[model samples]
Target chain A: MRKLREMLDKADINQFRFWTQIFFFALFIYGGWWALNWSERLPVFACAFVQDRCGSCYLLGLQHQMTAPVSRMFSLAGLGILTGFLTFLIWFVLLNKAWCGYACPLGTLQDWITKIRSGIGVRRSQYSETGFKRLKRIKYALLILLILIPLAIGNTIFGSGLSHEFEIPFCMICPGRTVLPIFNADFSQLMIDFSTSTKMILTALGMAVTGGFFVGAFVKKRFFCLFCPMSALQYLLSRLSVLRLVKDGGKCTRCNNCVQVCDVGIRQIAENMEKGDILQDDCMLCLKCVAACPENDCLQLKFLNIPVFRSTDTGFFCRMEKKERGI
Target chain B: MASEEQSRMAQSIRMHLAMETEDVLGRISMDEAPQAMGYFYRKLRQFFQQPEGLGHFDKPGIGTFCAQVPLELIEAAGARPVRLCMAAGIWDQAGGELLPAKSCSVVKAMAGMAASQLFFSGVCAVVAPTTCDGKKKCADLIETMGIAVHRLEMPPSKLSRAARNYWRESVETFMAQLQGWTKQKITRKSLHTAIHRRLMATEQFRRLCRLQTKGVLRAVDYFLVTQTGFFDDVEAWTLALSDLCAELEARVAEGRGIEKQNRPRMLLTGSPVLFPNIKVPLWIEQAGGPIVTDELCSATDMFHDAPAYDETCLHDMVSALCDRYLSPCVCACLSPNPDRIRKMISLCRQARVDGVVYQTFSGCLSYAMERNAVAKALADEKLPLLYIETDAGFEDQGQLSTRIDAFIESVQAKRRNF
Candidate 1:
């Protein structure tokens, strides 16, 4: 057991996280697509088994399909949607928003871009606190539009013929819908849809969002993850996650190690003195803060109150040794 | 005669001769040292002269510099605590190779001693505090020599409760590491015993400082008694100091003091003046002014406060140790170090000194930067203050003597005006 621990200590966890991101990115976008008949039942999200769909956006599409021929009235899902929400909830709680840190292909690609920029000796851009606060509000607005636009189309509140353009509204502009399908050798998304001027404009907007955010991700760490609507949805279920990052504020030296290492630039991890449940909304649960903290038991990765890898003075120095080696 | 027995006897005799030569050389080099220091040298010589095979009582020793290290914790872990200080000599060449030219001589001398295995021989570990940049890098340099250095880090500022808890945990972690190294358990009972032992020594030191201020004790005796405690056993040193304090009390009642000619009393503050590195104190005494009290880490500042003991709890005692030691330290490591100036003023008021000598080592920036604040505080009290920056070597003696003599004259003139 001790030798196993020594081996694990030698293994670079951040690099391990990088490979995990690649595996999930492959599995979600391209895994078993050729052989499987699991399309209609599969829930839609950027990370779900099906491509070109999102769970929330799919809920909107299902809402549209179910209510299109009836009177103008909003309708909710039956048993299948309930089961899909449960499945998504299970995956969401298992890693929490580690989906953002270690699984999101977009976030992973952004990190890769950051690495490339760092390789070319370019410094990162940091947003001021107020500016970052303003940026944070964008994702919630996107999340609200993702819900409201589909509801408007299902009820014909925005009028009947607008369904072609307004159904799956965020997916029309989502970079993931355009960018992720290419890994499966799908390039049909890149072409602008010419069905209507509105469809052309939505496809054009998708292309623009993809191009802008990819460049933004290259220059800033986790740039697109900051404004991801999916991340905003995941945070609503964050409190139920059993896999948690805990902080012993009494032991924390306010060293700013956690903040310095956080991909999302979380200040609460360092500045918080209150003891219970510091799993803040912006936390990716990357546990980079755990790796960086020098104090013993100061920051911890706990799964249902059992420690997996907690912070240690030796582990901190070991991570530093690995960082130096990487440099 | 048995041939193997005869050869073994011959080897033992040769080893003894080498030990004797080292002692003689150390004494001859420090032959110009004060009588009290020579007395301490002889006691240390006797203590270090024990043969091997002494059993668990002679556990592996851990050497450290700053008084912030809780020696009792080291004791509870079953390791002997040895205080590492700047040894007297011009042995700078080896340390000069390792340390930057701008580094303080005390750290340089420490590097020299560790490099040669001179004063630092037979030590299992060294605990060095990051009190200054020079000291921090000195710890690193010593670690390069394969000496295990446990760097006891303190917060840059001690104003917050978080900083206090951080320091307390750091001390606890250090104690745990020591326990692992020594294969001993640091029980609550043992920690209490250790705290009790140190409190006794602290009481004796307090009395010693009190006597020195009252002009009942000589300045050389004050420096010697406290400095020698760095090497002496805590119990024996306390008893020795208690006895001396009693003798001095009798002498004071009889109106007997070493000074036939009245010297101006000055409070010594700033960089530590270890034995053999006693040029500053030696100069002050020789120039018709005696240091009545000191704010140095090695002197009265270390003993100013005893740890607040809670007999039933180990964590409380550890917190008390952190509070007592880290709180009063005037080291520049703590920013906006107003506590230091406050401590100096309070000690000066009690000691009733005519002037304050704010001493700084050449590379010790923390104490060096405090010159303005110390000067301002002393000026407000209308007390004369002299700033002296020197190194470990004797090359600065002539210049230092001239400044001390002038400061003494000015302080005397100020007294005459009064």
Candidate 2:
């Protein structure tokens, strides 16, 4: 038991996160085309939950297929689609936005871009408090727009005889539709869909969004994660998550280490005084703050009241020494 | 031989201090004067002497600064643990090559000692704790100079579960390193024995502190007793202190203290005051106010809290070590260092201290930055705290004397009216 405890202490949590990201990134990007025989119609958000080109697009398509035209009520097939959504929610609750931290292929891609940027000695951009707050609202707005546009299209609330191009409204301009296929050695989404003026405009928007995500992620840590519609949805439902981040505020010395190491730059983890559960909206449940906190039991990662990992002074020092040496 | 050197230094300092004492107490050695302070004074002087050559030891000598490093671990590894703390008094030219003028005085003195390899040559390894940026960078510099330097990272937050775990791991790592250096296995038994010895030593030291608080023990005697632990082996030092405590308790029972009655009582707080660097405490006593207690790392701070070790398991012992070290530490490196201020306020109430003499050496930013916060906290309780910023220089003696004298006089006057 002592030997096991020693091994656990020596284990590097960030190393575990790194390999987990790599495993999930490969699975999501290559799984469908390779072995599982999963189709594009398989209503799962794990594939890539990006706005405009995400699993929500497939969900909306399934809703249109199952429900009677102009009727908002769910058919038997629509309940199947709802079950898919429930499955996604269950998975989300299990990890609780750790998908953003450990499984998001796009987030992992952005991290790779950040590493390249750092390798070239390009400093990452930091957002001021007000700037970060203002920009933080974009993801929620995007989520709202994603759900509303698809709902209107499915119900034919707009003019009748609309083109099939309007079927998945968010998917029409999602950057992932153009970008994520590159990982599978597919480049067909790179072509401009000049079939209609609307298709051409959507393709152009996709290209632009892809370019923006690339550059922004290069200059900022997890840049696209800041406005990820999927992240916003996960955060909204995270209250029911069994996975939790706990802070012993009395033990915390307000050292600002949690803030410093936080990829999202959330200060409340350290500054919180009226504390019970301290998961911020921007928190990815990355547990970087847990790894970085020098105080004993100041920050804890709990899975249904069982401690998985905790911040420790020795671990903090070891990580910091590595950071100082630029390891 | 070390004792002889120490007595010589002690004699010189007493003679120098006697020049000032004449104006206050009228021609008497500190021994004959009050509480038999001269004996403890001699002990402190001897401890600081650091013999002509580093004393012969069967095992490696592990040198460290700051109160964070646990000496018992070194002892358990069969290595001699030596405290390398010093003032600018003995710093040689070697220190100037590596450090800028703005560097902390303690680091400069340490660098000088390390570079000369004259006094600190016996140290086979240096266990440097990253308490402040000065010490952290100094450790790096020293490591590059080919000394086997182990950097101990103390988590800035004291009260956290993470900090405690990390400290225990750090102690374990250091223990392993010490065993490797000394080529001896540090058995669980030896580690527990070392911890038990420390607990015993600290208990005796606490007794002296309580006696000092009650005015039966002089400030100088307390300083002497505490600083001796830095040099002497725990067993001998504890026995000596145990004997001293018994003698002091007897005096207390007999209703005998220093000749001067109702003198102003002040609590000393700040940087570690070493031997030969006893000018600050001397001035405080000479000003007609005995320092009833101190919160400095080198003095009462080291003894006030004993590590409550569980003898059952080694891990529990290590946990106790972390808690005890991290808990009492009021070092400026920690954010929201309310414990130091809180301890001071509580000590003031218990010791019936009239004022506080807060000292900070120049360039010791940790204590300097904390001085205002401590003063403000004391102010809220309507306690008078005097901030004295100086170095190991004797040039500031007159200035220190005037401020302390006025502060003591004010306390006395206030008491007379109250």
Candidate 3:
């Protein structure tokens, strides 16, 4: 068992992450052909827009459930929302933010775009510290709008009610709805809806976001993840999750190696010395920090507080040596 | 290549260095000392007595004055890195003639060596990190002696984002300069291999440190083992350290380690204590206080941290190297550096140290200014600290020894009362 753990700790994490991402991407994008269904409350971005998707993202179901009349929001109708959330939490706690790192189809697509950018010798862009701080708040703001906009559609707010087109306000602008279905030869969502000005504006906004997603992801890694409301919601309950990223402050040298390689550019993982649980709001639990840390046991990927993959000098050197040998 | 006058001066300095080296070696050689220690002793003797035989002469040597200059880049550029910080009083006097009366002894010695044409004999260029005022001036002094000097500007504070970016750019610029000098592009494969080589040495160094903390290795022996890396080949030094660690492990298993159980264990910090000038450490050991660990750049801090790049790409690797060299450095030269106190407290706890012996040279303004802050922090942790201010000369040896002995006595008495 110890030997197995040593092997895992020194394993090629990039290769492991790549294969795991491919498996989940295939399962979510084409699993319906095999009659596989993992419930509509799945935590990751297995888009509902994909006609043959095995599971749908929880955000869509959440917006729909929250659209019930405000008068019956706390009644028996509300119990359905409660049950859906409970199921979503159960699935979320199993892997935590790894849903974004390894399972999310949208995230996988961004990673592929980034790979292409690097393959062509184009330099990737990164946010400055001030820019990162300011942009990180967008996700929380979107989370608020996603929740309140749906509720406002069901009830009066400021002496007015929103149209049904704004019922799933976030999903209306989310690039996933416009991009994911293309894998299934479904590009009908690409056109603007002219039934009403509200529908036309929302659908046009979605198309523009899809175009931005391609160009943005090509230049920056995990661009859409910066404003992902689902990530904000997961962070609110991140403490209840079983998987964690832990840091031993005394062992950390604040080398910023983790910061340089982070997909979401979470600087707290390297700079925060007072915090042991280093899972920041933007952390995708990608375990790249754990692999980059040179100090022994400085950063760890823990399942229920038991280290599954730890950073060690031997492990760090072995990985680099393998890279040098092109193995 | 040496003139008659320069050769005579080199002969005189070599004689004094050899005597000082033999004196320390004689004191460190004990029956309980590990057989692997002989390798380090021979390496040190060669460094002082036979400078030309230190090897690596096939490649152009790059002289570095501080640890901030990444050695991996130098090696990757197909050049050898020779750390030029000296602690001998002979070189200090020789260099004192050119500098002010109250200059840092380490830099003075380096300038003296450069003046004599003894140290920078075959070095093609020098990479000098402006860590302190003394080093910056020393770079200028070395440049005047006709050796090319590449000055690496260090940021005053590493806490700000601007500083971090500036440091990254500075390191990248230094990489370009080195490549230009060596006429060899630092390819990703070469840099990766260089980083791996250093990591291998770091593994062995950490093992040696663990043994030192366990009281299996003497303080002087540990210092010698690390100081040898300044002139020795990285691979050779790592192999010798590994052999020493294996022997120390066996001795620990046999319960044949240093028997200083009753003495107070000490953690040495502050300015670096190099070879032939390790008076404070020698005094601490002779006074029955064993130095379990140290936080000196000349020793533990030199190889303690290794770069950990997440990707194999050149850009990420260079950025990682910059972070590794800058962020973790607890040198007093960097301002608002609370990391030094935290590191000291942590090292104290890990080594089970009863007191800290902070040594700063008389002219080392940076370290001397940090003495009060370090003292207050250690006192808050209820750990006794003894701060010593002296130069490279032996005029104050008796006074320094008395103070070390008294501090150890007080620590032992405190333990007894508890």
Candidate 4:
């Protein structure tokens, strides 16, 4: 067991993450060819629009559950909603935000775009601190609207409402709805729907977001993750997750290596000396900070408060040397 | 090529250094001292006994005044980095004639060495980080002595984004200057290799620190091992340290540690305690207190923080190097540095030391100003602290020893009451 841990501590985190991302990308995107059906409520961006997908994103199920009739909210339908949430919670607690980092199909696509940009030697862009502060709130706002709009469409709220087109408000604008289906050789979701004005507007918005996502993620890493409503929802229950990103403040040197490598520009990882639990709302639990930390046991990925992977000088040098050798 | 007067002066300085080195060696020598320590002891003796023949690097030497200048950059440029900070009464006296009497002894000794041209003869150029006023002046002093000097400007504070970017740019500028001086273009591969070499040495240093905290290695031995790294080849120093750690580990396994269980473990902070000037540490040990660990920039802090870069790109690696050298530093020269106090308290807690001994060279105003803050922080933690103000001179050794004994006795009483 100790030998396993030593190997893990010195493992090349980027290689591990790259292969893990590819494995999950294959499992979620192409699992149907093997007749594999995992679940309908995996808390990642496994789009329901993909007909052959093994599982659907929990947000889609959540929106459908919220659009139930008001009278059914207290009945078996309500129990179904509760059970579905518990299932999502169980899946979430197993990996926390790693679902977004390693399993999200849309996230994988964005990483590929980033690789292309880096290959071309184009400098990646990061948001200014003020801009990041302002934009980080958009995810939460989208989360609120996704829940409330679905509820309003199902039942009259503050008067009258009748528009089923707004059923899954976030999914209509989410770029994943249009982008992920391309993997299944389905380009049908790329067009703006002309059936009705409501469908026309929502589908047009989706098309625009998809275009923006392509360009934004090319120049900026993890661009779509900035406004990902699923990320916002996951953070609400982040405290209950068994998996955690823990910081030993006493051991941290505040060298800013973690901040420099963070995809989302989370500076608090290096600055916050008082906090033990370092998982911020924007953190995807990618363990990049742990990989970048040079101090021994300074940053750790702990499950049940036991360190599974912790930062060490030897681990840091090994990873850098591997990168140097192009391994 | 040397004048008769200059040769006589060099001879006098070497004699004084030999006497001081032998005195320190005599005090630290014991029957049970680890055999691995002979390497460090010989290195220290060679440094003083043959100052002219020290630092035999295959590559040209680049002198660095402070720890802020990244050694990896120099190594990447195919030059060896020789840290030139020193502390000795003879050199301080020589430099006192050239500078104001109120300058710190460290800067004074460095200026004295530069003036004599004994140490800087082999160094092709010097990179001086403007960490404090005295060092900024010392850079001028070294330049006046006809040695090439590059001033690496350090930011006043490291907490702000502007400060971090400024430091990165400064480091880049220094890298360019070093490349020009060494006439070697620093490629990504070379930089990565340099970083790896230093990381290996840093790992070994940390292991030695762990052994010291375990009471298997003595404090003076630890200081000597680290101080020898100032001029020794990094790989060689690392190998010797590895041997020392191995021997110490065996001793620990056999339960033959050097420190007595009843001795009060102390944490040393405030100012860099260089070699041949270890009076405070020696007095602490003689007063029944063992320095298990320290927060000195000249020793443990120099190698404690290694650069951790994510990408292999040169831009990302250089940025990581810049932050590694700047952000973690708890130097008293940096303003608005609450991290220093926090670090001192953290070290005390980690080492489980009975007390803290804060030593400030008499003319080191920066560390002197931080004494009250350190005392207040230690007081809040309910740990005893002793603040000593002296210089490279030996006039205050008796007084400092008396104060250290009283502080240790008080700590023992406190431990007993608890």
Candidate 5:
């Protein structure tokens, strides 16, 4: 450990290094994206016989299973299920937001491009914490609605309840695939083949979802965070995340120094405070606060007691270091 | 017999004028120059002899400031601070004199004084914040002729840290500019002394506000307290204050303080309520209501209740003053934060008000902006809220009557619940 510390004493990591790590993380993400690409990727539980699709499979990137490209290569349906659960565990436990932070192909590409094309001044919506936070819940709610009540009109005289089927929402909505198509696959045919009823549903869903994103991006940049219920899901489960933002408030000067580097605009510590070396929601657990913190060793990315990153979380490491010494 | 009658009337007039002149002379400090003294004497004589209704100070929404401005701040600044109050005995004289019956009675009374040329013109300046949409416009209308109407933009933000900074800055700006305008380096010693001296005026004002002895404040005597508008002498406005306070104190001591009327306690807000307005007060009284005090910024008696601090303590003084009578709800142009509404309603509760009549104006940004929060607050309190929308000139009373009747009924129902 001493040797590791001595080795990196002179190192000054910069944005380029962070960008380099993001590139590797994307390749790593391909492992899970590959599994969902398979056809006959039958869900394991009673859900398969009872319902056609599962939320986890949709999460695993199973847009369509029958014509899935990876299915032609791999025969076993269980392998796809196995691969997805493994990926969820890896991402959920080890690097909760690693997919969003470093590995998400779309996110990485966006970051790289954004770095190069930097003239887009922050939109007014990004600055209004109260306004933007209030609006972000709509997206996560849509995700839950899209998955949980898929194709079901809730119980009534004309009852059509939640459909347990793959939502055509992604095909109808995600412009990201067009910009950077995954697997070099064309989704246009899949989009056109959906029945008229499905098309209307898709179109309505598309208008709501797209309008929300565009409006969020333009009006209050990242308005999605305020209403996106999935972020809340991620936030609730973020306690299990290895990477977390830790604040050494004793060292904090109340100068509001770390707020600018944060993509999400949480100004005060209480609103932005997290337990470990990485922030919870809106953090992407990217160690932005660590980099932005002016106070020495005020923020850190720690693995157990080890300082994986030279962050503000290190003082607590040293404090623990002293307690162990006392023992 | 005609000669005898004329002679007797002349004697009575002479005696009244003499008593009024003595009252004025006694109140003036010896430090005042002969001209200022003479001005005081003339003002007293004219007011007593003619007693033209002091309606300018009695405008709708004006009662809020009239109740707050410490008479000492006015007098020491060499200004006469009036109560701008109403529901006094002079309503018959001042009411409907200039303002139409449909107009806000408080506004009508003020218009009466303006039409009668009683008070608003003979003043150095008027001081109050933009307490409400109606009052702000009225004060602006009265701001010409170097009248220097100072409108403090009372803080409108939440009561958090960010809001506090904004309010402090506003307070600094208002007090500093006012210091420059008043031509008196209003020091801590001066302001503090003025606050201490204002205990006398407060005591006096409390006397008239008492529901005893005179049944209610005679509109004529209410006119005197509201004359904090006429001059800028903090120390000298106590002549009438002394007389009124003495009479009320004596009455109270003699067990004369009894409930002559069982009018409902109402929190009058929105317009600059002037005294002697027959419409608003009369309507309130008809509806079994009597306005105790109100939440107005200009010409409401809030200034008197404010505690004076050391002048140098800018932020502390501002925080105190900002919270004194001007809460975030005062600046209804901004969304009245839930906390602001909660605070204002709590104040209503403290004042033991049975109902709130928030006078909103069409196209006025402040009241309209705060309308939702104020509504939500009233809903929370379960208090009946009457939102009266009026024009800048309180010109439409027929439009307000049915709504008023309904609101009064709602309050009566709530009282029954209690």
Candidate 6:
């Protein structure tokens, strides 16, 4: 049975994995949308849902920036937390962020935007292609924070005072509040609970992020990653993940071919240290490097040091390795 | 039809008279036009009159390579590298200062540096690769003896093996002379160490890249790290970098890499930016995006170092360095077949840049040619782009400011859907 499973996996590998990842992710999203009860739909506007909103509100409160509306929102945030926790539990245990690979709504949204953006002006290999594939970790970190911070806050027993609620950590700049269409509604309705002082604080945080992003135009690449606490949080979580792209040192040429394509910022050394594996914490794992890699086996994500896919789904990607051995 | 014809004829006559006036203008002032080389000739004459003045030219440095490498040879032969960059910085220095607005800023700042005594103190030899007229004119201002001047005669074409060989020989001979003059032994170990140091430093550069992985890196930071190649002493840089690497690695290991997440995600593009305009790069990072990969003079994806295969069988690393065909300063610019834009496009595409800000320097005819080529190339790739021309100065804020704003807008627009 094991041999049969391995053999079935062996044929047209990358294509199969790529397709399977897409199929699974699509199914996951379709299922989520189907499950989102009707009354909950538009209420999620300007926010991810009650679960995410409640989490952010409390996190804001912990930061001493929360308003009554924001505080009240947290009373209902159990939903985002529950869904997020359940999804994460499945992701960490069953597939190691296969949620990112096959199911994340935010990740899916980013993919659509990326496609449109690339179609308009971005391309796979038009110019300055370094670290192109690595750009995904920006969101991955955000996702991790969306889960961990709220849980950490909910469990804290620091009693009563405003300082006690400081346990909610992701409040001020949580991207989930800003990125989802649900949040767009929340922002539009000004549903935020606030006194003038608290409102000012929320406004300051909001303006700082919005204004900063606009200014970051000529300023830098992935500027949000610089300040994204979620990115910070995920950077910790990804290290222990099961799946990763690994480099077989013997098959490597140190040509920087992989660095040429990583966008998420995986340093060539970090990738190389992992033996050129792309655990790709910084990466969305969109699989761009797996395509751009010139030498076969020079790049691949592994689970406990085993090749999962090598460029193009052909069962025979070890061509570079074979060629090197001919001598 | 007849009236239009007359009008055209009249316009031609006015143009002819204007030409005469320009000729008379040459006769009138010191910064006049030369009749033969036309305006360039007059600028040349005036430029030479104030040879060591600001904006005149850059002089020789401690070392030499290729055609420019000869100045070092001449200096090492006991003639001081009393090239323009030297005297221009003296208290008495005053190469006819070029206008601030019209000139290239790189040309201006470098000239300004030389004129300020910050550049050419105690330098005694000079070599120059006559790759550009700006450099040639800069050399013309120096009051150095012809014997002291060493001009590297790089075959304008880069591909021919003979030209490469000529460059190699010129460098070797210049190096030998430099050794003779400096009285410092040119040991193989030092050169090897330099190469190895650079290799290691280049490897350590992985930190800036890694930091950006999770979000701590901004686009501006990307630009700074990518261009670390232009700094002095690769060995010292590597040593210093070790500290930075450890700090950043610890952060990443602890999963505390990026400080925040509100910054923009951007792709770096443009012509090979020469120097860190300091403010521009820092501002870019401050403004919220940092650089990632670039197609600058030093940050070539072709960046690599192959160890001498037969280590036991001693090898001359300097010879190896020469063979890189394009060293930091001498590459595409000095090549008989200079095709920097082609290489630039290839690199940008490989890097998956979201946009390109092509900075064209004033008076770089070669770059002018590249402008259209790169635009067309990017257009085909469907990559959004912005082009800015700077004379390499902080003073030209009007043009730079406008271009920068527009560039930021374009990037923001792309980011809006986010």
TM-score of chain B of 6: 0.65
Tens-digit lDDT track of model 6 for A262-284: 43434452225334544544454
Instruction: Pick out the ten consecutive residues of candidate 3 chain B with the lowest summed lDDT.
Output: B49-58
Q: Please provide, for model 5 over A1-327, each residue's C-alpha lDDT reduced to its tens digit, 9 standing for 90 to 100.
A: 777774342233334346655545343333344443222221210011111121122232433332233334266774764675455555566665543555434345445443433334332423455654655566566556544432232222125333323343443544332323323343342233345666656655655654555444454323444443334455666777676556654334222334434556555542233333435455555554454343455555666555666542232223222322332
TM-score of each: 0.52, 0.53, 0.93, 0.92, 0.37, 0.42
- C-alpha lDDT of all candidate models, in order: 0.68, 0.68, 0.85, 0.85, 0.45, 0.42
Model 2 misplacement above 4 A: A1-327, B1-28, B33-50, B92-98, B258-261
Cα lDDT over the full model 3:
0.85
lDDT by residue (tens digit), candidate 1, A254-284: 4455655676777677667666678866677
Candidate ranking (TM-score, best to worst): 3, 4, 2, 1, 6, 5
Per-residue alpha-carbon lDDT of candidate 2 for residues B337-392, written as tens digits (9 for 90 to 100): 77777667767866778889998877789899998888888888788989888766
* CA error at residue A161 for candidate 1, angstroms: 64
> Candidate 2 local accuracy as lDDT?
0.68
- lDDT per residue (tens digit) for residues B1-418 in model 3: 4578778988898888788778767877477678998898888888787666534477878888888989999999988898888788888989999899799889888888788776666677888987999999999988988999998889999888888888888888899999999999998888888888888898899888889888778788888888888867788889999999999899888777556566788999988988778788888887878899888989877888877754467887788788889988888899878888878887888789999999998899999999899899898989999999977867798898999989999999998898
Model 4 / residue B118 / CA error / Å: 1.4
* DockQ score for model 6: 0.01
Q: Candidate 2: lDDT of A215?
A: 85
lDDT of 4 by residue, B295-399 (tens): 999887798877776556678778778888999888999989888887777777777888999888878999999888888888899888888887886778778
Worst 10 residues of 5 chain A by lDDT: A44-53
Which 10 residues in a row give candidate 2 chain B its minimum summed lDDT? B20-29
Write down the RMSD of candidate 5 (Cα, Å): 20.1
Report the CAPRI category for model 2. Answer: incorrect
Among all windows of 10 consecutive residues in model 1 chain B, the one with the lowest summed lDDT is B48-57
Q: Under CAPRI classification, how is model 4 graded?
A: medium
Question: Where is model 3 chain A poorest over a 10-residue stretch in terms of lDDT?
Answer: A318-327
Please write out the lDDT profile of model 4 over residues A25-100, one tens digit for every residue. Answer: 8888888888988888899999989877888899999998888877999987798999999999999999999898
